[model samples]
Target: MRNKVTKAIFPVAGLGTRFLPATKSVPKEIMTLVDRPLVQYAIDEARAAGIKEFIFVTSRGKSALEDYFDEAPQLEQTLRKAGKTELLEILKSTNMDSGEIAYMRQHKALGLGHAVWCARRLVGNEPFAVMLPDDVIAAEKPCLQQMVEAYAETGGNMVAAMEVPSDKTNAYGILDIGEDMGAMVSVKGMVEKPKTGEAPSNLAVIGRYILHPNVLRNLNRIKAGAGGEIQLTDAIAAEIGTEKGVYGYRFRGQRFDCGSKAGFLQATVAFGLARDDLRDDLETYLHELLAARKAAE
Candidate 1:
């Protein structure tokens, strides 16, 4: 029997250069989506997926991200004194228990593989999930939870997979598929950010993964693959022919690449519309904005 995936890794070391001025003072992971921060959504998802230990791979200028998870004592006391039970309860959800979380610093911007590797000591030899908060996913069942259920059946290694446009395949780690198993596909190989028209398939790897520790070992062998960075795709691909072969699971969710400004705005709008209290006003405002733009055009 496979040991449960009780640990999860969050790689939030990126400089968020795409969001520039806004990220100058703020860690991108703490940038709020509607009301809650991106990191909160990721933590909720990880907890829902049965992750017992949380690990964050961080870098410089990320103190804000670290503080976000810490308990807000003064604020909680203020709310509690005001008889604001609901609000106080909301604040309580954010506190991570002692020893429940561990943060490791990634001194250099080596890449995804290196960032994940930094958490190796804590992870040891167990299977762990890696979640990229930037890829905020909206799903009936949290994406990682869906993956955990899937992982139980196929225990080697699993990466969340999604079908993207054929031309857009170059932007992702395309999977060379073996068997067509509906929602789950057997991964024969991985092509990291393939050149235009060089992609073998349109099924691209996403940000959530149930990876074996061997992938961490593989990271030591890879110097750099694409973008002169140690690509996680290369490490995962190394498992293909080994005993722990990789599998691609098409998750049930709509993922937003919040690393980009446009994607961030889009997620804000989508999440705003999803909320019962905000829906009517947000939808009305969006319609008015569209009408104004069309009138100008």
Candidate 2:
């Protein structure tokens, strides 16, 4: 039997240079979309996928991110005293059990591959999942859970993939199609940020990944590719044509790239509209704003 994927690594060490002054003090992972922080969505999704070990690859200034998952005893007490049971329940969700989570400092701004490699000791020789907090997926079934189910059937290395427009292909890791298996595609090869119009296929690799232990071994020898960073795509691509080949899972979800300013705002609006309490009023405000822009136009 294949080892069940119970461990997940979250690479959250990036200096949120794009978000500037706000990120100067606060780790980007703690930035809120709706009421929950970005990392909370990732964590919740991992929990839904039955992940037990949460490994965070962090940097020096990410104490706030660490604190976000730590128990807020005083706040919980305050909520308890006020009889805010609903609010207290929400707080409980944020608290990670003592041994359930571990943090490893990357120290250097290397790359996704390097960040993941930092957790190799913790992961041991088992299959593990890597979730990028920036790529938030809104799905009826969490994206990782969907991938995990698929990974069970086809166990190798699986990445969450979605089709991108040809013009936008240059911005993503484009996959070369081997076999189109509807919801899942057998990956022929992976090219990290191929030149526009030169992409093998429009299927772009996203954040969620269920990787075999060998991929971590592959990362051990990978050199920096594309933008002078150790691209994770390279290590994964090396597994193509191996005994357990790589697969691209077309997960059922709407994904938002919260790493960018535009994507962050779009996710904010999308997530705000998703909340029943805020939906109607937020929709009305959005319509009003659009109408005002059109009138100006």
Candidate 3:
């Protein structure tokens, strides 16, 4: 029987150079979408997917990310004293029990692969999920939960996939598809950041992944590809043709790349619209801004 995927590794060691001045003080994962932090969204998704062990591969100056999950004693006490039960209930979700969450430091900013490799020991020998907080998925049933259900049938490695324009394939890891089952595609091959027109298919790999433990062993070779940093796709690709080959699960959701400024703003607006509390005000504000721009023009 396949062991239930209870553990998840979050690689949050990236130097948020894109949002530098803001990121200098706050880890990119702590940046709020509407009101909840980016990492909180990832954690909530993982929890929905039945993930019990949360492992965060972090780096220096990421204490805010760590403390975000820790207890807010004064605030909790204040909420209790003020009899704000609803607010306290929301705050309780942020606290992780001792040993439920583990943080490991990734000293070098090698790559996504290296950051994941840093959590190998914590993952041990089991199928685990990797959630990149930047790729926030706004879905009724969270993206990871969708993948976990698919994994129950096809017990191999699965990465979240979405259709990107052929021209934009170079920005993503293009999936060389074998058999298309509508939602899940059998992946024959995966090429990281393939050049334009050279991509096998338009389906591009996203940040979410449910990888087999063997991928960690493949990382031990430490061969660098694509920008001199170890590539997780390369390690996963090695398992092709072997038992339990890699697959791409075309999840049902809109994925926002919060890593880039444009994507961040887009997600902020998208998430704001999703909230009933903020929707009307936000929509009116955006309409007013657009109307002002038109008048100025």
Candidate 4:
């Protein structure tokens, strides 16, 4: 039997250089999508997937990210006094129980593999999940939950895969396919940011992952690959053809790369339109803006 994936590692150490002035004061993960922070979306997804322990690999200037999960006693008391039951319930969802979440500091800005490696001791020998807060997915069934269910049936290293344009393959860890099995594919190899026209397949690896502990072990002896940073894809790629091979899962959702400015704005608009309270007014404003742009053109 495969060990259940009860723990999840969230890599939140990256300095959000892209967002600049806003990120200077606020960690990117604390930036709100609709009303909830990016990290909150990740935490909610993990909770839906039945993850027990939440491990965050962080760096300095991430105290706000850590504090976001802490309970606010005074705020809760005030809510109770005002009889704001609905608002109190929403606030309570942000509080993480003691011992349920752990934080490990990544002192250097090495790479994603290094950040994940920071939490190796905490993950122990069990299978664990890795979630990137920047890649938020909007799905009826959360993307991580989808992968966790699939992991139960096929117990090797599983990565969330999506088909990107062949021209854009250089931007992702492209997969070399062994067999194309409907929703899942048997992965023969993984290439991180392959040069143009050298990509094996357009099916690219995304942020969500359910990995075996051996991948972490691979990181222990890993040399820097690709962009001179410790790439997590290199570590996971090492597990391609062991007894339990690596597999790619095509998750059901629209993924937004929230790390980029364009993607962030797109996600905000998309998520805003999805809300009952904001949809009509937001939709009308969007149509009016488009019409005005067209008139100017």
Candidate 5:
């Protein structure tokens, strides 16, 4: 059997300039959906997938991201004094154990591929998973967990794939499929952000990936691709047709592209509406907002 995927690399080095002034002060991963920060969601998903060690590739000014996993002694004390056991438990769940977490700085904002490569020493020669906190998936089974189960049987590189509009293939890595094997599709090849009407298929790759260690070495072969930064898709594409070929798993979940402002707000509403405490009140406000907009129109 293939080695168990105990380690995961979270490439959180990107500077969230799109959010602008807000990101200037807060790391985008620490931005909240409702109460829990986005990073928490990713961590929870990692835990659900049986991930043992968490490696973060952070850049400068991402101290908040590091601090988020630290224990909150003062807050825990206050909850203890107030006899709020449930509240204290909720806060404690976010803290990582002493050696459970590791951080490496991505000195430069090279790209996603480079950010992950920063954790190579920690990852060693074993297969590892990569998760982008920017992609928050809501599902009965977390997206990464679903992929992990599939990886056990398939034993190669796998990425979370979902069908997208043909016109929007330019925004993502398009998969050239080889076989339709129910939940997983054998990926013949992939093209990074292909031009409109030039994509091989509408199946776009998302943020979750289980990659072989050789892909890390493959990063050395090619120069930078799109955006003048090394692209992860290019490295994965090079593995096509090999013995350990890549597969695309169509995960069962609602994924939010929290990389954009609209996606973030949409995720907020979807997650908020999923909560029992916030559903009624949040739904009422949404209806009111829609009615007012209709009236103005």
Candidate 6:
């Protein structure tokens, strides 16, 4: 029987160079996505999927990220005294229980594989999930929850996948498919950021993953792959032909690559439109802006 995946690793060691001055003082995961921080969205998704423990692989300047989840007792008490019940309730959700979360610092600025491997001791021998806060996915059901449900049936290594234009395959880890199982595809191999005209397929692996513990064992080998950094794709691909199962789940969601400036702005707009309070106003403003641009053109 496959051990239930109850722990989740969040690789948030990135320095967020793209956000420049803003990230200069703040961790990118703490940046807001409409109203909530990127990490909060990820935490909510993991909690929805029955994740019992939250493990964060952080870097030096990320104390704020850790503190964000800590109880804001003084603030909560002030809100409670002011009769702001709704706000206080919202604040309460951010406080994680004492043992529910753990943090490990990634000393080097290594790649995603290294960041995940940093949490090895905490993950122990169980299969686990890895969610990158940068990939903010908005879905009817949270994206990770969908993948967790699928993991029960497939029971192997799973990565969230989405179809991209063939030309754009070079920008993502492209999947080499073995079998078509509707939304989930049996992954024969994963090629990391394949060169143009070298990609096998347009299905690209995004941030969500349900990885077996063996992958961490493979990461222990840790030979630097592409770009002289440990690549998670290389470790996951090692499980392809072995007993370790790896699959690509075509999750249903709108994924925003918050790591990039343009994707960040796009997510802000999309999320704003999705909100009942902001939709009408934002849509009206966007339409006027488009009309003005067209008139100028």
lDDT of 2: 0.94
> In model 3, how large is the Cα lDDT of residue 135?
97
**Per-prediction TM-score to the true structure, in the order listed:** 0.98, 0.98, 0.98, 0.99, 0.98, 0.98
The models' CA-based lDDT, in order, is: 0.93, 0.94, 0.93, 0.95, 0.94, 0.93
Residue-level lDDT of model 5, residues 134-176, one tens digit each, is 9999999999999999999998899999999999999999999
RMSD of 1: 1.0
Which window of 10 residues has the lowest lDDT sum in candidate 3?
A: 233-242
Give the range where candidate 6 is weakest over 10 consecutive residues by summed lDDT: 237-246
Model 3 lDDT per residue over 1-297, tens place: 888899999999998999989999999999998889999999999999999999999999999998999999999999999999999999998999999999999998888889899999999999999999999998889999999999999998999999999899999988899999999889889999998899999999998999999999999986889999999999889888789888899999999999999999999999999889999999999999999999999
Model 2: which residue pairs collide? Answer: none
The Cα error of candidate 1 at residue 173, in Å, is 0.8
Q: Please give, for residues 185-292, the per-residue lDDT of candidate 4 as tens digits.
A: 999999999999999999999999999999999999999888789999999989988987899999999999999999999999999999999999999999999999
TM for candidate 1 is: 0.98
Against the true structure, candidate 5 reaches a TM-score of 0.98
How well does candidate 4 match the true structure in TM-score terms?
0.99
For residues 1-297, write the lDDT of model 2, one tens digit per residue. 888999999999999999999999999999888899999999999999999999999999999988888999999999999999999999998999999999999988889999999999999999999999999999999999999899889999999999999999999999999999899999989998998789999999999999999999999999998989999999999999999899999999899999999999999998899899999999999999999999999
Looking at model 5, residue 36 earns an lDDT score of 94
Cα deviation of 34 in candidate 3 (Å)? 1.0
Give the higher-TM-score candidate: 2 or 4: 4
Residue 79 displacement in candidate 4 (angstroms): 1.7
Q: Which regions of candidate 1 are displaced past 4 Å?
A: none
What are the runs in model 2 whose C-alpha is more than 4 Å off? none
- RMSD, every candidate, angstroms: 1.0, 0.9, 1.0, 0.8, 1.0, 1.0
